[model samples]
Target: MIGMFATSKAGHDKDTVYIIVQEDTEYVYLADGKYKDTEHPKKKNKKHIQIIKKESDDILKEKLIKKQPIYNEEIRKAIGGIVCQKQM
Candidate 1:
């Protein structure tokens, strides 16, 4: 699958980047190297943003498999809230 990586420039001045796995539009957040969950206003919940300090490509691949779905759901819920806000 194609994966696109991008960074968020909103808060903490933290180096937050996310990979979008093309097959299912899954998102995996990486910060530092290992996997960690941090809170950000943009995230639907605290776990939506994860910190990965120095993970290898192989490790990312394995973690991505499980993290993708959870991230995707958080994104969906965040977007839904935005749409609902606009409607009202």
Candidate 2:
């Protein structure tokens, strides 16, 4: 379930959280796009992404359905929160 808010654990994107825009059996199209306000999604191997949690998806999906923008900061906060929770 490498969807929105998944973080990169390996490869060129290590340590960056990304929003997964599309996926397949081997790879996912990630939008680090919010970083520059352009739709530059990087496609990476599925195994490279770390799933911290699915806690953000439902909320984000609701916002998406309402046509609200999901900023990079929100994704960063979600990942940061989840990582903190796991450390506890």
Cα lDDT of all candidates, in order?
0.37, 0.64
Clashes of each: 9, 0
lDDT of 2 at 25: 91
Q: What global local distance difference test value does model 1 have?
A: 0.37
Q: In model 1, where do residues sit more than 4 Å from their true spots?
A: 1-5, 14-56, 67-88
Q: Which residue pairs of candidate 1 clash?
A: 31-52, 32-52, 32-53, 33-52, 33-53, 33-54, 34-52, 34-53, 36-51
lDDT of 2 by residue, 1-88 (tens): 4345677888766877666655679987776544532155687788888765554657765664464667766556655666676579
Q: Which run of 10 residues does model 2 get worst, by summed lDDT? A: 31-40
Tens digits of per-residue lDDT for model 1, 11-85: 673435544332323444332222332222223222344332422244444554554433444433433443354
> Candidate 1 has what TM-score?
0.25
